[model samples]
Target: MQQSEVTESNDQAALDAEALQQEIAAAGAEEREAVFRAAVRAQAADVLDHTTIDDDSNFLEQGITSLKALELTRNLMSLTDVEIPLVAIIEHPTPRDLAAYINEAYAAERG
Candidate 1:
């Protein structure tokens, strides 16, 4: 990738991070999970360069390469300012599962 492309990607990632935070924060307790799942779906789609991804679709099965998994992990960490390991993608393997972990992290951050 060219320098300009890298910079653009970084800027877009920053914007996505901010949007993810806002989306989750705006949700009430009962809606938090749904909101988080949506955010996770968006992140996965962004990292995979897809327009949309099913919440329960296995990431690896969807062709998420190691590099894309790393990008997804970074995006999730940025979204919540939480430290998530790279293996999280393998363990969670789906937006729904990852959302649960991310929501837990967000709640912990609030505590």
Candidate 2:
């Protein structure tokens, strides 16, 4: 193959690798979000009904007190091996938002 063709092939390979890495990262993020949601739901179970813990539901409105939020943060930190801030659940205020925050923080910590 010509030098130009070789360079093009290498470039394509690099691009493919980057895409695959992105896909893997995205999958990992989704998994993390799912786990976060489940953990939050479990923690909230003592206060809220099982069905009230949907992704978009307001945790505070569902009867999650500040103490429960702190418990959740600790539980999540233990489960995920990530150092979650005590106010994270309060700051995020919803399962989806909290999951996203946790994912971002976890990624930053990993990097």
Candidate 3:
């Protein structure tokens, strides 16, 4: 890639990081990323490679493969052991959406 492309990618990554941090904070404990947690951070880091993802980004449209999805699912399961339906992720592609779904699921499980 050209120098300009590299610069753009870096800017996008920064934006993504900021968006993610805001989302995590807004989600609170139930949906928070727990950055100190290795597994959660690793999962977030893995997905961060797809810098094109925005709050409204479509994971499927952006070529998020089944394997990557599975990996994310596995990582999440390791943390919460909640069996999130694959279709849920397919339907809610953005981090904010996924965070909302996970929070709801966690609440339902608790109550």
Candidate 4:
């Protein structure tokens, strides 16, 4: 992608992130968890071009490089409006774990 394309994507992610934050704020607890999990799963799938993903699937094992991990982190950070380090995803290593980590981090950040 070109520099302009990257900037455009970032701009759109910011706008989408703001809207996601609002939607998340309005959701109930269970709904919020579901939202995060589903978002993580979807983002992972889209990033890796995998059609189906299990919550417990290991991203690294599925061939995720640092670049791919960074992309995933960027998208999740945009969706959740939280700064998730790429290392966190490596440590978490699964969609369920990553989603929980992001949710917890987001909660702490929000509080």
Candidate 5:
């Protein structure tokens, strides 16, 4: 192949890589938010029947129990397709924080 043709191919390959990275990032973000929201809702439901809370709501302060925590983790595992550490759930008790943690884990696992 000609040198110029090889350089053009390399350039095309770089652009393709950049595009793939952007697409992966976008999909990861969307999946992360979706998983987090689903987990939060599941946690809330486990704690309170027919109740709704904001994304930033504090589950612990609102009486979220250990059993409910496990339930939420289970729900998140189903949604995220990633193995969530029990420690992470315990460390990040609030819904928003836990969601962010879950997002990171999901993205890392994908990477």
Candidate 6:
């Protein structure tokens, strides 16, 4: 193959690798989010059983108080081995937001 063709092939390979990495990261994020949501549901089972918990639903509105949030954060930390600040639950009130935050923090810690 010509030198230019070889370079183009290398570039394509790099792009493919990058794309695959992104897809993997996205899949991992989705899985983490699912797990986080499950944990939240489990923790709030008493209150959530009668209500639907969507991604955007407010945890406070669902009866998750500050003390409950602390307990939930502790549970998450034990499950994920990531240190989540107490304020994180307040800042990222919903499971979706908290999951994203935890995933990002986990990735950063790994890096």
TM-score of each: 0.77, 0.65, 0.54, 0.81, 0.62, 0.61
**Candidate 1, pairs of clashing residues:** none
Tens-digit per-residue lDDT, 67-91, candidate 4: 9999999888878888899899889
CA RMSD, predictions in order: 2.5, 15.3, 9.5, 2.6, 14.7, 15.4
Query: Quick one: ranking by TM-score, best first?
Result: 4, 1, 2, 5, 6, 3
lDDT of 3 by residue, 18-71 (tens): 665455446656445333133333454475464344445566765668877777
CA lDDT, every prediction? Answer: 0.84, 0.70, 0.60, 0.86, 0.66, 0.69
Between candidates 1 and 5, name the one with more favorable TM-score.
1
lDDT for each residue of candidate 6 in 1-111, tens digit (9 for 90 to 100): 999999998887566546544443566666755665655555455344535567677778877877777777775675566789989878988877877887788778878
Cα-based lDDT at residue 47, candidate 2: 45
- Candidate 2: 10-residue stretch with minimal lDDT: 16-25
Question: For model 2, how does the per-residue alpha-carbon lDDT over 33-84 read when each residue is reduced to its tens digit?
Answer: 6766665666566445455577788877877777777777775665556688
Model 5 scores a TM of 0.62
Which ten contiguous residues of candidate 4 have the minimum total lDDT? 27-36
Residues 1-111 of candidate 1 have per-residue lDDT tens digits of 999999999998788778867867888755787877887798899788889999899999889999999988887787767778898889999999988887777788888
User: Worst 10-residue stretch by lDDT in candidate 6?
Assistant: 42-51
Candidates 2 and 6 compared: the better one by lDDT is 2
Model 2 off-target regions past 4 Å? 1-27, 46-52
TM-score of 4: 0.81
- Best TM-score among the predictions, by candidate number: 4
Estimate candidate 5's alpha-carbon lDDT, on a 0 to 1 scale.
0.66
Ranking by lDDT: 4, 1, 2, 6, 5, 3
lDDT score for residue 41 of model 4 = 91
Q: For candidate 3, what's the RMSD? A: 9.5
